[model samples]
Target: MHQQGAQAYQQTANVVASSRERESALLMKAAAGLQKIKDEWPDSYDDLKPALTFNRKLWTIFAASVTREDSPLPHDVRENVANLCIFIMNQTREVLLEPRPEKLEVLVRLNRQIASGLRGM
Candidate 1:
């Protein structure tokens, strides 16, 4: 038998599946918007920033919701997409000030690092 999280993912598959028809597109859209922010924005925060973290259900829902085409691309293509999402978000918070700034290679690197660091903890 699957664990609660896996079982939940299965049960909610229809929620995502049914909503995907309408919100999947929206999630795609939202994901694109986040990508745009991530891509074009800069890290002005310099000192302190928000970090990305995931709660299990939310991660399950987020992972379950999108198809392959979304921006940030739902890393479930590999594993633990929610953790990746949190990592990126936290890294983004680290490098970026987020009133709005342009994207940088540093932001991507920082995001990656933060995600990687998170897995260790």
Candidate 2:
């Protein structure tokens, strides 16, 4: 019984780690997309809409997960995540309205930082 329990725990841990890694990779990809838009702005303005929309969708999913009553995260962490999601939504709206290259920097930085944090965890 003890051995089986240990094995199950290890399996769960591995699954969680894999999920985190995937999430980090996705975040990095999104950030890279934003960076590409910034590098090729004006010509890339059309691309900005899709990239920003993708990120908004991703953050919305995360916000939903973290805010769930059954979420495993601590209350404070969940609250913080919810708040960050709100900020992301607002920022995304601003970027969508203006579609400026400089505005993308904030989204890029946020994605990279969040990805880094996810990777560390």
Best by lDDT: 2
Residue 42 in model 1: shift from native, Å?
10
Query: Model 2 reaches what TM-score against the true structure?
Result: 0.96
**Compared with the true structure, what per-residue lDDT tens digits does model 2 show for residues 8-121?**
999999999998898899999999999999999889987988999889988999899998889999999999889988998999999887777999888899989989998899
Query: 1-121 in candidate 1: lDDT tens per residue?
Result: 4598898998887664554454334333333444454554454233123222222223345545543455444355435555565655554555444444443344434434433443333
lDDT of each: 0.44, 0.91
Candidate 1: Cα lDDT at 20: 41
Model 1 lDDT, residue 80, Cα:
57
RMSD of each: 12.3, 0.8
Q: Number of the top candidate by TM-score?
A: 2
TM-score of structure candidate 1: 0.31
